[model samples]
Structures are given as structure tokens and as C-alpha cells.
Target: MLAKFLPGARGAVLPLAILLLVVIMVVPIPAALLDIFFVTNIAISLAVLMVALNARKPLDFSAFPTVLLFTTLFRLGLNVASTRIVLVHGHEGEAAAGHVIEAFGNFLIGGDYVVGIFVFAILMIINLIVVTKGAGRVSEVSARFTLDALPGKQMAIDADLNAGLLTPDEAKARRVEVTTEADFYGSMDGSSKFVKGDAVAAMLILAANVIGGLILGPVSHGLTIAEAARAYILLAIGDALVAQLPALMLSIAAAAIVTRVSSDKDLAGQIGSQFGSPRTWTPVAGILTLLGVMPGMPHLLLLSGAAVAGFAAWKLHQIERRPPPPAPVAAVEPADQSRIGYEDVSDGMLVRLDIGYGLVPLVDERKGAPLMGRITGVRRQLSKELGFVVPQVRVVDDINLAPYTYRLVVGGVVVGEDQVSPDEMLALDTGQAVGSLRGKTAKDPTFGLDATWIAPGDADAATGAGFLVVDPGTVVATHLNHALGQNAADLLGPDEVQALLDGLKERNPQVVASLTPQPLALTTLTQILRGLLAEGISLREFRRIASAISIAAQKSPHAEDIVELIRPDLGSLIVQKLCGVREPLRVMTLEGQLEGLLGQAARADTSGRHVIEPDLGRRIVDAITRAAQPLIAEAKPFALVVQPAIRIAIRKLVKTCLPDTPVLSFFEVPEDKAVEVVAVIGASQPAQAGHFQPQALPA
Candidate 1:
């Protein structure tokens, strides 16, 4: 059982050491071991200071706060142990406590206990008032500022992730680093109090040793006043000095860590790189030289300093004046400026978005490239709805475009062009806005609705007024999405059709094997799929489509005939897209006489297409368009149910005006679904407006 936990056993050392320190407070220790403990405390303090100085940033030494606590606790414990030894055995000699304390007492203080006392007082003031106090304040302010900046930094990370400049893992790592920095500063703020408290404890420990040792030396051990002063008082100051020096070092280390600015280089390197300029050193050399020549100054030392400063200034100046190294040249000759490669002339991207210079910030990586992320989302959504991987939209800056304008191109043709201010939002009045607003009046780029370009700050007010507000990136993205929908048929080709078949073959091999590269060629299949997409049908269910095409191909040899034969198989899919299974299908129809006239012409011609007189054709188109307007106003999906022979002719006739409205044959709708006739074309009756009128017909 222990073997499972052994890997993490290394973390137990710190707790064991802390427990030992706690024991030392109550237990008495001999002089020999006490010397080792005192030395180890000083060494730990020095090592911590060195590590603090070498850290490139505060977070680089994230463990310093915990280390500060441990070192402070251990130093206090040493003071406790050494104080016991000093009072109990001071009558013997200065070395009674330990050699480490004796050297500080006798050799450093030179038997003058008063001088040692003054030195310890100075160290205490510097640690408590100067270093520890300053570090605490810096940590407090740094923590506050770091937390305050958190929201903006997090948004920047998200923007970069969406813009494709950073991968998800890299963004996650940066977020962790930001959070750790905030935590480190907060810990440092708390840890600085440990240093302050340690300084206070040192003063108390000194007093305890001196007062306790004095009363005990003469009364308990029968020593004279002179001998007692020589032994106990000096030893007290010495022991306090041993602990006080390490405390001062820790205070300095805490200050250094909290004050440090994050950088790629260490403290010494940052200082040298920033301060080595001749601009700073030249003034230093000149000022020092003038001071050296002053009558009251120490001429020799000041002149020597001036000379060294002058030499450093000259070296810095020479380095600054040196030119950078020349870039390496390729061995091959350079191409002529006028010459161009195929990459310059050919564009591999099927979809491209070009923005003007004024709109560059929307796609600028430093600005988080908000448009790039939005474009990526548009491509992802279109790819999902179209059942094929949409080509990447290449965003480029074009100088030829006017300011704030962007153009979307599909297959080298400009499908859409519009303008949107990068720093403004569009507040669209979607038939619900009640109040008037003051701003630049414009039409919604995606749909021509009344819109105003308003500042982002006004978004709440606009929403309160029932306006739908969206950002500039959203406006551009939605425009691009709309354009892609209209041109979806152009997005598919032979390669895409083949990929579809191959994917279907993986799961439904028989269906694919019977359909493709057999009765129908790849080009014919591609054209058929394009026709379906042109009429607002998605190929998401590729297996079903492949099976339908396989069955339809058996009765029909031509691609158009196959499409007609396959309509019954795909009826459910088409109806489901237009409305839910439970919702009745809303429809418009040609009057009996009008349908027969077109049907007769369709049957008379060998070709599927039927020609009608231009005036009559115009009247028939106007009647259907007028009838469909009410359905459009209500936002209901409806189709024109017609004779199969004339459905193709009717479809081509109305396609230019009502591209999204479906033209279905009599047998296309599922038998289980209910149908509500919204209008009957060419019928002499009262016109019904904005409501469904139910009617019964022969089966």
C-alpha cells in the first residue's frame, strides 16, 4: 500500500522539518548540534537571497513565499535553542552556547557587547521598516493591478485562439501563466508579513537572552558582575546577531522578488542592458570629473572613478555607433523585379475575402483579428449545412478598395461587396424597434433592413428600444454567410462529388457501387448535386442520397430523368427542411385551366422545356408572385404544386424572381402530411389575405 504513495513521499520532507522546528522550541539542545543549526539557518537565508536575485520574474520563483515562511520559522527555532544554551551555561565562557555564536560575540563584537547591540538594532530597523514594508506594499499593488487587468488579458487570449494565431493548448497555457502570476503576487503580499514578524521576534529573543542570562549568571552560578557581563551579555548580543543577519537577508530577498518585473533576462542582465547606454554614462563621467576637480573632494579616489567612468562611456559609445551585420545573400542570382511566378497569377482559394485598408484592424492579429475568427465560424457552419468541407476563405488587404469596404469572391466572381466600420456596431430595426436613434443611417448588409451605425456603448439603449445590435465582425460574417448560401451550388465540383461517394462507400458500399461511375458519370453526378443545392436541398444524409440515386438510375439513363425519378425518394427530406413533420405544408397552385395549358405545351415538345407567349407568361408569373407575397410576409414555407410535365418549365420561369420557393409535382409531398392551400392561381374568387384557406380535392 505504501509503495503506491512513495512517489509523492518527497513532499514530506518540508513537513518533517517544520515539525522538528516546533519541537526545538520546547526541547533543550546541546552546544555542538546548536552550532550546526545556526549555520544551516544562515546558509538557507543566503541561498534564498541568491535565488531571488537570479529569478527573471516573481512567478519564476513561485515557491519563495512558502520558503520565506519555513526559513523564518526555522530561524526563530534556532534562536530558541541557542538562548537556552546561553542562559544555562554562560558562566562557563563565551563559547558555552556554540562556536558559531562565540565567533560573532568575541571576534566580531571584540568583547564590546554595546557595539553588537547597536548593530543588531540597525539590522532590525532596515529589515522591518525598509525592505519588508516596501515589498508588502508592492505586492499589494501588483496583485490589485494584475486582477484588474485579468478580463482584458483573458479576452485577448480568446481572440488569438479564435483568430488561429494560437492553438487551444497554447492559449490554455497562457491563461494558466496569467493566473499563476496573480496567485504569486497575492502569496508574496502575505509572506512579507512573515519577515516583519520575524524581525520583531528577534528583538524579543535578544531581550530574553540578555535579561535571563544576567539574573541567572551571578545568582544561580555564583559569578561576579564583571564576569557575568563579559559572558552572558556579549553571548546574548552574539546569538541575536547570528539570527538577525539571516533575517535581514530574507527581508532583502522578499523585496527583490516582489519588486521584480517579468523579463526574459535576470536582474543583472536587465540592469546592464538598460544602463549601458552612453547617454547615461557620458553624463556620469562628466559629473564625476567635475566633482573630482572640486577643491574639497577626495581627488585621488574621485579622479580614479571619473577615469573608469569615462572609459566605459567611450566603449558604450563605440558599440552604439557600430552598424548591424549585413544579411546573408543567397548564392543564386535574384530574379528580375518585373518577373512573376505562377503563385502571383494563380489563386488556389475558391473563396476569398478582401478588405480595405481602413478595415485592416478587423483582421489584424495584434488587434485579435476578430474578423478572421468570425470568418472561420462562417466556413464551419456552411461546411456543416452543405455536407462538404467548404474551402478556406483567404482574407487579404486590398489598396484598390475604398475605405471600410470588403468584397467576398467565390470562384473568382465578386458575389458581395459592402462596408462596415471596424469600431461601430449595427443596430437593426427588425420591425420591433420603437424609438428613433441618431446615427449614420444605413441598410443591413446581409438583409436590407433599416439600420444605424452606433457606438458599442449605445448597445444597451438600442436593445432597450427593441433593436437588434450586432458587432462589426458579426455583420461582416453574416454577410459572408448569406453570400455563400446563394452561391453554394458553385462550391461543389467533381472532386467534392467523388469525396461524397467515397465516404458513403465506407458505410454503404452497395449503394455507392450501384450509382457512381456506372449509369451516371462523375460530372453528371456533380451537376445533379449542384441542382439539388441550387434548389435549397442539403446533402447531409449522403447514405440515403446514394441509395435513392442508385434506385433512380435503374429506370432513367439521363441525369435530368434520374433527378425526376429520385424526387419521390427525397420528398421527406425536402418537407422536413421546409417545416416540421407535424406542421402542415402550405402551398400555392395553378388553377386547373392554367396548369393544363402549360402541361399541353410541355407534352407537345420533345424537349422538357416549354415555350409560352411572352405576355401570357408575364401575367402568370405576376399572379404567382403576388400570391406568394402573403406567405413570405408571414414567414411560412410554401411551394407551387404543379403537373410533373410542366413543373420544369414553371421552375425555370419563376427561378429568377423567387429562387428559394420550391416548385413541386403533385406526388412529391408525403401522403401522411396535411396540405393547406394558401392561394389558387388563375381562379375567379375572393382573394384571401394573410391567412390559410383550407380546401378539399379529389384523391
Candidate 2:
């Protein structure tokens, strides 16, 4: 009843009990109460030991570290309480402190204080030197190893998640478990010190009790030196023994917890299953029988051991040979029925990779499934950069595809389709290859570079000719990566958004709560995030995005308005993808008159949107494309800098013509960045000019 607080059932009771521990040190208590508290301490320690023994793994008893500290505190408090009682009332009789301590001193130790002291010393040695020391070292090493393995385990979960072997929920749960395991070991590393200190404290308190009692018994209680020795020494050893026993149990329990390996069964079950094998006990039976026949040995004892070992081996052998219980047979179907299932009506897989018969060998596991391995790598890298887990890619062999073709479908639409010869290698010439190979040439499926489908035997020769050689599997993976990156927005939905919100809630619940179920609901947030993704924004910094939205929602109820308000906060994320921090942002600007014309048209419009006339829109698109050639020739990263109000309008116009260029509003470029105006479209240069000089930004 006193220990109900320790198990964490009634949280309010724990503080009161911890206060009581402090009270026990300073306040006096009756012998009867002391005995009851002593019994409770022993009971709690025994319970902890049994729990540790029954646990299949260390994490099963995750609270062991806290429990260890409380148990140690309780033991120390009792030591103080018992020491005071013995010093004050020792000369009274053998029962001065309590029946518990008195029983330990007189009956258990046979009324010999010297013998009791030796026994207490031995128990302390076992607890401190053997058990406590060993468990502490084990905990230190376990914590270090667990921390070191964290990164590799995290990567494996990411790989499994992206490769479609695990769902998003399972991946999240696994990540939490890995982090918890690391924390548990780290805590245990420190908790082991408590047991060691308790063992040492028990020894010091025993010495203090005996010495103090010796001084008081003779001077104040009118007892002789011999009488004082008999009373004080025995009482001190009794109090020490009572406390030392429980401390030993706790040490053993701590050792058991740290040393336990993960298994499906308890310690006893593990030991029994492993040791009861016929092969193990058969050797024991043979050794015992051989010893039983020796002349100098105890024949009767060895022969009895041989009989038990032989019987155990026989029983284990019979059990091993015993057939497993018969399983119930399933019933046959009553009739053949045609029915519609959910799977037939709806397709759950968001991305599907269709391959022709010639690509079958590349996906077959018996032949090493090289394509499957590369695809998993691509999924891992793509998921990391995109900031959300992409849905599974269902790779199916399609008969409709040509013998050498592969198709990538996102959301039931074929976004990318290409061909690769399964038995050949692709050697891409990056405008640096000196020699040519006699092979059928084609454009690279991903980069549009001139490539040749050369035989596998010619891969080395192609590399020797400065050609970048890749297998059919790498070619397919590269194309799929490109297609997925372009269509990433299609992969996100309410489920993924809710997943992001739920994950964010773990770290920043206030942001999620403020943003959702308020000015912005789930569907609204989903659409807003999808819009950003479509505009080539990554959600890797999800917390920043959510915070920006929460702040922006106060200004507008519309999703578009909220998104526009949040774009400045998302500016850094956007600029990073185009160029590094130290590099200047190369951008093309609209001519002053042309931009002024668009802004005036936007304000004069009735619907709050402006559309350029057909001839004018065509002229603008042509001019932007022509101006972009300078940066393209320099092979540098660039975007079109425009007014914020007309940014989206211009993005739609230039996207198809120059899909690689990102259109950024002026405010979206972080202020710290230096700007270089690569060109001015709609200037004096003709719309169809082959090239134009770029302008530099004014100071």
C-alpha cells in the first residue's frame, strides 16, 4: 500500500511519498511502523526483480531506470530510520529496533554480531563488485552502440518505406521505436550508478550505527563495554543486513535488464529451451556417468546426476521427435460466385511502372533484379529531397508496350515512356568522347543526350572512348526518377498531408492546431501544399511552411491568398534549389514598360485577373525564350524575376516554353542574395532573335 505511488499509477501520490522519504530521515517512527516499511521495501525490490526476469527484452521494462532510483532512495531512507532507532534504544534489549532487524541479528545470524558482519560484507561485495560493476559497463557499451547504429537504421527504414515494403504509418512507428530504444539505453547507463552508490552507503551506515551505539550504550545507558558491544554491534549488523539483502536483489535485477537480448520468451523459457536440447544434455549424461565410475569421486552423487541427465536427454529427444499438433483443414467452397470487390473499382497504387517482355529479366530476382535495386535507390533519394514519402511504384509487365519499351504512369496517366534494350548497355557521349562505336544510336531517355545501345561486351571500350556507360536497369531508374520528380505534386493527397500534420503535431502542436480546423481546414491546407509542390517547391522544411500558413491564415480565408502570403517565408527553400548560397541568383527581368503595362491591365480588370491578348501573349513568350538563351549558353541556373501580382500569370505563359526555368516574384528572392539580371525580355531585341546580351542589376 505504501508503494502504490512507485509504480506510477497515482502520479499525485508520488510527490507526497518522496516527501515522506525526507521526513523519515528527520522524524522518529515507532518500531512497528519501521518493520512494516522494511517489509514493503523488500516486497518492492522482489517485485522489480521478478518483472525484470519475465521481460523478453530490455525495452519491455522501459521504466526500470526510474524504478531503480526510487528503490535506492527507499533503501537509504530505511537505513537512516533504523540507524536512529538502534542508537536511541539499543541497550533496552534484542528487540530494540524492531522484530525484523532483531530477527535478522539474533535468529538469522545466530546471535553472533561478528558472523553477521562477515555475511553483510559478502553480500555487499557481490552486489557492488560483481553485479553493479558488470551491469554498468554493459549499459555504457549498449548505449554507445545503440547511438552509433541510429543513422543506419533510419536509412534502412527510409529505404523500406520508399521501396513500398512498408507503409508510412509503419515507417513512423519504427522510427519512434528506434529513438525510444536509444533513450532507454542512455538512461540505463546513468541509472546503474544508483545501485553502486546504494551498496556503498549500506556499508558506511552500518559502521556509523555500530560506533554511535557503542559510545551511547556505555555512557548514557549504564552498560559495560561488553554489554555495549553485544547490544550495539548486533543491532547495527541487523539493520545493515535487512537493507543489504534488498539492495542485492535490485542489483541483480538491473544486471538482468541490461544484459537481456530480445526474444519471444522469458528468461526461464529461454534457458529451458536452449539447455533442454538432446544434444546439450547428452554430453552432460556422458560426463556424469564417466565420473560416477571413477574411484576417487563420490559415486552415489555422480550416479544420481547421471540418472537425471540421462532422463532429461531421453525426454528432450522424444519431444524433439514428436510430430507437431495437426492443424485443422479448411473447408471447400460451396459454389463459384462472381462478385465485385473494392480492388476492382479503385486503384490504390499511385505510381505504376510498366515494362515490356524484354525488360522481364531485369526485374526477375533469380537473375538479381538489378532494376528493382536501382528503383529502390531512386525512391530513397527522391523521397529525401521531396520531403514526403512517395507512394509505392507498382512495376507490372504490360503486353501492350513494345518489346523494348517501358512506361511510367502517375495517377493513371502515362507521364513518361521510353525504351531500353535489356541485353545491351547505354553509352552516352557528353560532347567529350573522342572515338565512336559502330552501334545503333539513340537519344538518352532522361537527358536527351546522344547515346548508343552497345553490347555488354563493349561497355569497357565505350568507357575507354570517354562515353558514360550504364546498364539497362540504371537507364530505366534514371528515367523513372526524372518522371517522378516532375510529377511529384500528383503523389501527395489528404492522407499524406494529414501524415505531415500529425508528425508536426509531435514537435510543434501549436502550429498545427492554429493552422488546421480554423481559418484553414485540412482540404484547404492540402490544396495549398499541392499548389506549392506543383510550382516546384519542396516541403522538406514542413514546420516553417506550417508556421507561415498559420500566420498567413489570419489575413485571408482563401487558399490562394494564404499561399501568396506565405511565399516570402518559403523564399529560402525555393532559391536553394536553383543555386547555392554563395552563388549569385541569375535572373531575367521584364522590360519596365512591359511590366508597367501588365500591372495596369491587372488593376483595370474586373475579375481581379489579367490576360494578355493572343498576339501580345505570343510575343511575350517568344521574347522570354529568346532572352533565356544567354543563360542557357552559359549553362547557369536562372529564373524570371517579375512583379508579385503578375508572377503566377507569367509562370503559366513561360512554363511550357521553358519548363526548366522557375518564375520567382521579386520578394521571393531572399534579401541577402545578390541579383544578376541576365536579360531583359520585351526590350528592343526582336522576339525571335537567336541571342541577346544580359543586363546586370544596378547597385
lDDT of 2 by residue, 1-699 (tens): 545746655666779889999999889999999999999999999999999999998889999999999989988998999998999999999898999999999888999998998998888888899999999999999999999999999999877865557877898889999999999999999999999888878888988988898899888988888999999999999999899888889999999999999999999898887887999989999999999999999999999999999999999999989999899899987754687678878667889999998899999999999998898888878888888877778899999989889999999999998899988899999877978887889989997899999999999889998999999899999999988988888999999898788768978999888998987889999889888888888888899999999998899888887778898889888888888888888888888888898888777777855566667788888777776776676678898989988887788888878877898889999999987766887675433445535432221
Identify the leading candidate in terms of TM-score.
2
**Candidate 1, residues 1-699: lDDT per residue as tens digits?**
233568676677666787899888888988999888888888989999999999998888999999998888898888888888888898898778889999998788787998988888888888888888888899889888988998899889866644445644577689899888888888888888898888888888888888887789789998888888878989999998899889889888888888888899999999999999888878888898999999999999888998998899999999989998899886998779898988898678888999999999998899899988888888777877888766678988999999899999999999999999888989999988998887899999887899999988899999999999999999999999999998999998887787677657757888877887897889888888887888777888878877888788778777777778878788888888777778888888887887888787788888545677677777777888877777787778888888888887888888867878898888788999898878877776555676544222211
Clashing residue pairs for model 2: none
Give candidates' CA RMSD values in order. 14.2, 7.0
Model 2 Cα displacement at 675 (Å)? 11
Q: Give the lowest summed-lDDT range of ten residues in model 2.
A: 690-699
The lDDT of each candidate is 0.84, 0.88
Q: What is candidate 1's TM-score against the reference?
A: 0.56
Instruction: Give me the displacement of residue 446 in model 2, in angstroms.
Output: 4.6
